[model samples]
Target chain A: MARTLITVPRTAKRDEIIEIRALVQHSMETGYRRSSDGDLLPRDLIRRFTCRFVPRVAANSNAASTAGDLIFAATFHAAIAANPYLSFNLRATTSGTLVFSWEGDNGLAQTETVSLLIA
Target chain B: MQPSTQALQKDDTQNPAMLWVKDGEALWNKPEGAAAKSCASCHGEISRMKSVATRYPAYSSTQRKVINLSQQVNLCRVTQQQASQWPADHESLLGLEAAIAKESRGLPISPPTQRQLADAQKHGEALFNQRVGQVDLSCRDCHETLAGKKLGGNVIPQGHATGYPIYRLEWQSVGSLQRRLRGCMTAVRAEPYTHGAKELIDLEAYLAKRAAGMKLESPGVRP
Candidate 1:
């Protein structure tokens, strides 16, 4: 499984361009890891990721538990790398915050927060 | 004192934690890679980090979440050591944690106290009791009810923190509370959680509460 380690600036000028990383620890078992019976494990991966910018960016991940604030979200299909890694560059132009999160076949949850400067 | 049970005896012989802890110990002293900043570079001395693991599973206000020792170490690697995470269950990760926990052995296992801790505990307890899958078993079924009974070829300990980040024979490596929980959920055919997650954080609160007052023994050897 890939652990998502996110990094963003502590403070950014309003509308300042910032970079973000979103990754997940996932076996991404493509119907693998079968038992002695040899049954397929079932396909699990980030299918696609949508990066939306509202207050910051709205990300709709096929794996996201919910949709909102999410600056970047993506669904990883079976082909995505194990512990899928995603990164983004966005402009922070408002007093709101930038949200970073990921979704996976296992479960769609795990988030890290970064505050945007209101300058 | 000669080791008693197979669990105890097994540890002295082929302890994965010991193996990883040794690596961690080595990493502590020998600096390598680009910048050549060994962990000891900023930490100074092992003795100085006294009781460090005891306060772990603590809240990281900077990151705005609760994190354990292993996660904290990984964070340092990315931000400070200029390294990346060694796979979720990677030996390097477990070993690094074990080495740190080994240092805190005997220090009290204290849970963190922040405004949100209580809420986290509430969420944790809820999740533990929620029955899932065909077995229709909640974590409480085995851990709370048949806690001491032998199941799946091993005596289920009280799930204490006295020997956390402990080496496990099954894993062939040291493991965190989150790792153990994920395995259990998968066993019951429930959806498992990721390495760093809210469920893990909540469960940390509940388990630490269960093991409160017990000394922390990082890099602990287990069967």
Candidate 2:
């Protein structure tokens, strides 16, 4: 629940679409476990996440959720490792910031914003 | 892929990441401590001490705490041999822990117990789901969302610890699972804890148990 990662590629070809992969640290506890004391541990996991991009090239060239949108959202399972990982693609653009965010099972959340540039 | 083929890809021990395992092995028996106590000097031939590494992050009633083998080893060095404890990411420590976990490949992961072990697990589970950092990403984000899907140029297989003490070419040496965990925390811009720290072990115990029924794969590899 406390760990996450964000990596924005240094450069991308204007026409080339590449995937951004990530993994986080969390137990994704299913609430089915008992501690050594035999008490139940509540279920907690990252429920969902999103990636977005906004154009910064020209002053008025903001990308819409439709065109430069990550558009892909994912739901992670509790059985996955701590710090679950994901990958999504973004359309190549001149310059922008790619935003990634996640919300977990027990109400935990995190977000990462990275700068991007396309030559 | 067929189930068997799928199984093979998921088996990290057999993956190319095992090069670090060999490195850890060389370091394990070599003597460099102040008291001349190599891991072999006290633990003996690790191959014969089956499963010791797999049951780590277990609770310790003697210390009223939960400790992993790495921390335990550090304790021994400081207390038993009058040597300074190595930092969690110290090459010798990571190499040794990775090697031990690697040796425990395919073994069972049983966490040690203490009076508060359950509470620790609960806290750790909460931490896993608790949101931190600006990323707002939880541990479940990738492993669960895209489990078994190819992501970021690699398969987002289940976040299982069949591999620990893995070899990351990126690290250029054996890496303790805690090291990877630390990487996660750092990426999220959270405060990083020392390797082999109790919090790290608790998280480790929780994840390994969650990954129960899966064979151990110490000294695993990943891109």
Candidate 3:
């Protein structure tokens, strides 16, 4: 799994747009490059990234559902550099957890979670 | 530097080298080796190391030579911490160097000047002026004479060491000043000294002196 870094505010006022930033370590190798022996290096990169917010569990619920509304998403290509860094804003509606996930070539997938509190 | 590169350096969140700095913070506090001592055990809080990087490539009486911060770290590892030396360009070494250099941010570069170091300093000065390799170009040719001029669509920087452990867009990673020097030598088709070699140390000393009074900006982002 690629190393990841995620930044999100712990608390924010209702309806405020909070900044969210994330970075993931990957080679993002383009297929055009050649190896020392002249063999072409295969392209490998994080192809997709998604962020969603899971709302606070209801009082009657035993567990919070896994699904949530998508906050942000991006599709990447070989042009992206080694570490894909992304920053975006989120409008706070309620206290919840922000889940970030990335999918890439060679079966690479990574996810990170951060909590957000509504004040 | 390009505006985009400068922006990356100014914003910690945008600087990719911050990832290594985070890793270095962990290594600083984590104990290892036979002595079970971490860098923190000796150096205490990293804040105490402020401006330390600027004073490096200074004379070391114990070694009877000038040594850079990376060499000092290795010396401490082997002699004090009872750990093996990290290989050249090792991620752990680069991480620790970046973390240490980060502490010295905004401080001025000030290499030592003492009677004993005068000879080594002279040697370094000579090396900087001497032309070699197929291109036969000296450091003065570009950095001193052609500074601020455009070359191959890129501005020629004075080639100061102020921003070492820099995140070069070309490298796509953080690297040391010595590594940059080696790259320059290779560009001129000159033979580069081995990592940790005395010649490299002397060159570093001279560069540090040349950059005196310049602000330190390690883990800097550059194009």
Candidate number achieving the greatest DockQ relative to the actual structure: 3
Q: Model 1: how far is A1 from its true place, Å?
A: 26
Model 1, which residues run further than 4 Å from truth? A1-119, B1-16, B32-34
TM-score of chain A of each: 0.63, 0.80, 0.92
Q: Model 1 over residues B1-223: C-alpha lDDT tens digits?
A: 1154234424422333455566677778766445678789989766666778887777787788777777888877777778766667676777677777777767888777786666777787887788976678888888778888888677776667567676554544457777788888888888887877788878777777767788775656555
lDDT of 2: 0.67
Please, what is the TM-score per model? 0.60, 0.56, 0.93
- For model 2, the stretches where C-alpha displacement exceeds 4 angstroms are A1-119, B1-19, B31-34, B112-114, B194-197
lDDT of 2 by residue, B122-191 (tens): 7677777766677766667766776788765667666776677665545544567788888888887888
- Model 3: CAPRI class: medium
lDDT string, candidate 1, A67-107, tens digits:
44546656566644454546678777765455555554556
List the lowest-lDDT window of 10 residues for candidate 2 chain B: B11-20
Q: How close to the true structure is residue A70 of candidate 1, measured as C-alpha lDDT?
A: 49
Each candidate: RMSD: 20.4, 17.5, 2.1
